[model samples]
Target: MHCSVVADFFSILKKKKKNVFFCYAVLPQNIGTLHGLFLFFISLFPFTLILTTDNNYLFTKKKAKKFSFLVVWVQFFLARKKISNSTESIMDNAPAPSVYIKTSPRDSEVEKAQNINSATPFVTLPSLPVPISRGQCVVYDQEVLICGGLYTRDCYSYHVLEKKYKKICSYPKDVKLRGHSVVKRVNSNTNDTMLLSFGGYKNEKKHTLTMKYVSVWNGEKQTSNCNQWLPLMDKNEDKPIIIGGDEDDYDGMRSVIGGSNNHLLFITYRPKNIDVFNLDTFQYVNRGILPSDNWIYFHGFVSKTKSELTSTSTEANEKKSEMILFQRKTGLAIEYDEDSKSFDFRKLSVFDDMAPLSEYAHVCINDTILFFGGHGGPKLGVSKAIHKYSLKENTWVKFEHNLSTPLSDCVSVLSEDNTYVHILGGFNDHRDEMTIHVKTKATDWMDEKEKEKMQIYNREKELEKEKNRKKLQASHFFCCCLFFYLCCL
Candidate 1:
């Protein structure tokens, strides 16, 4: 029986008229373990030999188990040989991956890819419902909720992923907001996300003021096409809390900062006071007054430091704490100490020579503060420059690129990953939306040494590619010769 099986296997192998020595050379040394199973399979399925290839063999699970050891050995042998012969060739011929490095192409004939303009970096998107400015937007899930900027109660939700806009529930009948601070807060008790809109001018005259309103959308209760805006009431008073009041024109300057536990800290303009709102109780309290400086239209946000949390005993020690209020302008930054309640004003060491700018769209990304186009004086009015301030380096670098349009009062939101910044509805005549792709990091602006290293690295790659081309040519020739020899056999 064993002799018959062996004869049948060889007969089947011979019938294919393949290179027998080539097959033997490629077969794993561990083929002795699969010899019996291989013979059994050959006896069972005479056609199995036809499926064998220089690199691979196909078998069903059951048949595969019978020849498992042989399959592994064959795979190993083929993989080793292929990798040994192809490694250098592949590395040399394949296009190098894109890297964030500055280097000129070695071959002058090779066209270099265009560098993204850092100055007007924003790519325009679809226009809004109307030419709106000073609008407030809050990002919820994949959508951005825009409310009351064009002197109308026009509320719309923009689907960021779909690039489509759908009008949602309008603001309350009396509430029209522009230049408001909109924040998405979660209800700790019910765990529902709530949209909080606070402190904005009401009309084109900028006379009326809309203080605060909370809107909630229940997808289960309401249809997918509509959402209901409900007034958030103070638990004790049974009335909606008026934030900053109807008299203060705190447009474009209200900022929500850090709060502990269920409490949230909000800094508003005009009064320049910190208001603490308890999410758990729906109550508001006046905490501390900011410096009595002209804080109008200035940005403020809470920045926490480790020292602030650790130094609890004395006000002097608390001054060393990390909790700070960061305010910015074109050439100025005012830092407020949260613990000591002191203000420290510093002229921006860099870009101080540039004209002072205001009403611009700004967003904090990672350790950098990006200032988009804002209004400057005559020479720099409605500026298009995109200035980036590095928090770590304490320096300002103005990007040579500019915005597509010179804009002010544009709302800017950084994507969750900090890859793109979306600017919407600025002072431009058309409600043009734009996105700036944030690719180059602060460190990627290479110096001389880095640029030289990049050049050397690219040259080495070219040499490797040349070597690979030769190896591939040899491999093709060897394969062709082997094929011809097998055919003759």
Candidate 2:
């Protein structure tokens, strides 16, 4: 009876393939007692066993193989069950993965989308107090200050926030400045902010190279309302540093590039030299010569430090500054590496065809450089074209939206936020101020539809001007004919 019971237990172990070693080891030890053997086999809990006896003494090859197979099979089944349960639980609780399908839109649909998003770049603003051309315009405390143009010493400040213009103190009558470059500077020692007006055409023919520094913010005042212009006098020489020379050598058509804590840099045409003015000692020093002989008709200078452009926080603390110069006439861009103290000139391929134009107003904001209307291009008279050059892409894109009025020799100032470019005092019959809301992302560049619109606008303006011109000519002819008739009688 005991033997049959043992045989039945073995059969059950084989079927279950679990607790084979526990039963096998304990049962062999208690085979002499039927009840002990039966109780041990019945318990049959899962456990590992180390047999001290030799393999040949313990069991035959067939029995050992069976035991090994049972152990592995049981472990495999248990592991698979655990894995299956985990997978099912995850699938039940987890969110479904997202899937995207892309489709291309039709050309007409794309154009319509662009049209809905696109905006006219230029907006006309209120006219200045008086019509002035080739003047100086600078932004201070959200107000634009305009001064000294068309042989007038009158200066006015336009509050951008209020959209109002108020007459400010003018420069002295003796100091006549137009076609000059004005730069705002801060004194390191006094921490005073000042405006320096330098190198301009004065008295029509005379080129005044003298500089005048006026305290814009002396900590006491918010604006340059009652500030007096102080001539930047030489310490040793006790005289004004005469930058203007012979009209042929230096034509006084100059633009202020950028300045450091110690020196201010400016570019002059005719002679084509870069002059550095020592802010500390108040003296002039010639830095380098420009490559082109043609006057720098339109020029912009911006200084960028490595820290500003760097992405990594570890390298963003670098203090290296680079000065970039843009010459519109030749489409030459030159960069001065502060570390190497060398200039790298890069020819912009996009502006190759548009280099002949001059007198365009340009301003650098962040990485973008915008060129407004100017004269002396393929589009004669005043150019209604607006060109934008991106520094990051090193590419030029012309905007389809032109200025409200075609203008040249306008003074442009970027707003404090850099969103709007205020263009003031261009060569027009009336002094018209225009604001250009620079688009962060432009949809199209001079599309066919935009071109047609610009052509129609220009044609209408030209027709009106032609009618006025013909009437003036007829009046002059009649006067001459009447004068001749009276003389004859």
Candidate 3:
């Protein structure tokens, strides 16, 4: 009966006998181990296989039980080998590093000059808190303050020199203010670093009434104790001539205008007027009847110029540049000259080509204004183009490259090194998520065509992996067979 069983196993092996040697190595000797001498030798076979290199004993009847044990051991070896090879192949096909923007020095000569001019190695500041979205940030001496922002109610203050957020007393919880203008009071006899906060939404429902309050923050304390919110006019009037003081609070705060000295300026969108306040006395000076444009959002920046104008009277007054107003809807600038303490109101020539995507895209970097990333108009689909407003030339220059992704509500700031624009917290197209982007050089200002190419390259690599998958499977199978043979000894 034992001999008959051996014959049946040999028939099964023959039917699958591509590797006859490997099949034979698993077979027992053609005799029963129940015989006393064979049983003794069968118990010793595993030990002999462990110590000896001879292959002749493998075919003996006494080695049958040992051979069967060896075959079970070789199966585990083959399975382990198959797993290792497959794991190795998978690791080799992993994805590349994700680098959407890479910035290096633009000019070799300029880099050399910077190296010579370097007084100390610069330490970068930590990223801004609240991740600014469509707000205004201003720096004066050592303190950088952001005021009147969207999405966030609390203001942020950073000490640029020390790289720390100043611990200041908090304001009243009920006072929800934003979308306002801030101006640094440089010429005040007592306080050189006071910011005048004007305009922005005040309450729950979006109201058309202009907000009449002005807030002052001392740069040294960064404290609300030193900060005070004062109303420009009486708050109880039915048609209160304020930016965010209407029946309900919305439509954002008034746009701020900084003067040559201690006086501050502001304008309303609904009632359409301008108002001024003296920083020293907190006096209200109303300037009546602004331009008829209703859908305008304006901002002001101080520009001082001392020049000799040769007039008929042969008398020269040092003419400081106008506190410029940027009209959001029109993309036009209205200049308020200091000579008359009134707006010169010149129409900035807007070419049909110069319409910015929206007011949200406009940002001020140092002396220049940058505009980009707009929703699609009738003709232009969601523009990724960048436009620069040169304060010196009073002209716009279009940068070559657009953003890597189409995003709005991004926070863009010039680094303390003054070498890079760090843009943070915007949408990421590749991941279909919101991601941070730090724009370090001129190349980053460009369009998205380059980033799209790298994305396409990664997809092709995945395709190549699928094409070679069959070859990988065959390689793993051979490795399993070889491992099984090694274990059989």
Candidate 4:
């Protein structure tokens, strides 16, 4: 908060130097006014610091209550107003036709153009549904299947297009999970290409061993069914995390003959207790563990543009698709050595220019592993700038975007084309509560390219809107003049 305040002060001072100097006129009689303003701002600083800083105020229930109330009041007065203003201050529509597609550089030509872009989005949520789960959600086939999570009890699934979300019917009345894996099957021969949900909290009890279940939806019958809960092949031991689960269709006849969709890789927290489970064969093979905690936050996503384009609808045109696993907890990278037999797990690096990525948020698109806002340093809430790690270049590319406010716990999801990453819901330090934050502009490399086009288009639309206003005024004036002339005649 201090850093943000200082940065803002510098920016304002730079832009309005005269005004800043004028403030210096807080001399003599105006000294009282300056002092009062300074005192007011000092008082406005959040009270949370008082708890951590002042030992005298620590460990008192009565004082804590008072401090909590003070913090809430400050957020209600200052932060809420700022957030509310942001929604109305920005233009939420696509750039006007004149701005993006202009006839000439002339102001008149730009101004005369009409805006053809729609303000309404192609998709809109009726209401932000009561989010049931958090960490690593999966959108399989069509429905978004969110498993056991950091928050909430029963797991739930929501249809992306239908806007309908209900508790997972197959999910027992009371079951909770943490560190689970959810994968979607794509075999065309079988009728039940179900959503494979594995691991995490099976019930209120926090069990180290991971569990597995599959949910199947019948389009014809319009009824959903879930397979019986299947425990891992090796369940006696603790910390059995089912990290990666995907059909190995690459090795030609090897995958087809093996029928290996449930090729599960299980990991224990210890240094060397990794095991592989081939559900089709009902066999468990011992594989050495990874040196680092890579598989803990690893996410396996099948890319569609490389050699193995299996599940995606546009596979034919897309040419290739490789299963991508992202290891966020370790760093801005993915390690495959312990899991995959072929490649030795190397730190999958990205563009160096886009340095210091957020360790928390990352997503896979084709050959790119995109990361967004996270606490950069050891400090609990000190998040760095946004970044994208391209698998193609094996390097990082810095993104040009600044959040309205600092936040954490936000989630990102890619649309079908993987063009726009829709960031949603997070906790802000200012508000100190969970709030929804969406990307208003591009956070990718092409932001500068889009910015130029948007500027020109906007100027044209403004001019066109102005012309319409003038025409209406002229028509009104002529009508009044003719009426007065006829009256005189």
Stretches > 4 Å off in candidate 1:
1-121, 187-191, 200-226, 271-295, 298-350, 353-355, 377-379, 429-489
What local lDDT score does residue 59 receive in model 3, on the 0 to 100 scale? 36
Q: List clashing residue pairs in candidate 1.
A: 92-465, 118-401, 119-401, 119-402, 120-401, 120-402, 120-403, 305-322, 308-321, 308-322
What does candidate 1's lDDT look like per residue over 1-489, in tens digits?
A: 001111223543666744322122222212233443543443332222222222233333245446644554465445445444544543354433221113324323222212335443444456777656776666665566776574657777766445567776666666556556666665444435666666555333222222222223323345442355555566577766555545556666656544443245455555455555555565554455555344546453434322224425555544332223334332334444544444454444436523366667776643456777776656556766777665546777787666666777777765532335667766642335332222232223334543353344445545654455445434544554454344445
Task: Give candidate 1's TM-score.
Answer: 0.53
Q: lDDT for every model?
A: 0.49, 0.50, 0.41, 0.37
Candidate 2, overall lDDT?
0.50
lDDT tens per residue, model 2, 228-278: 455656668787654544342332355553433435455555445655555
Model 3 lDDT per residue over 395-464, tens place: 7677665665565544455543334444544333222223333344422432354234323433544455
TM-score of 2: 0.55
The local lDDT score (0 to 100) that residue 17 gets in candidate 4 is 38
lDDT: worst 10-residue window of model 3: 48-57
Worst 10 residues of 1 by lDDT: 1-10
lDDT for position 253 in model 3: 32
Off by over 4 Å in 4: 1-127, 131-133, 156-167, 201-275, 291-343, 350-359, 377-384, 402-407, 416-420, 424-427, 430-489
In candidate 4, how many Å is residue 170 off?
7.3
Instruction: Say what the RMSD of model 4 is.
Output: 25.2
In angstroms, the error of model 3 at 62 is 91
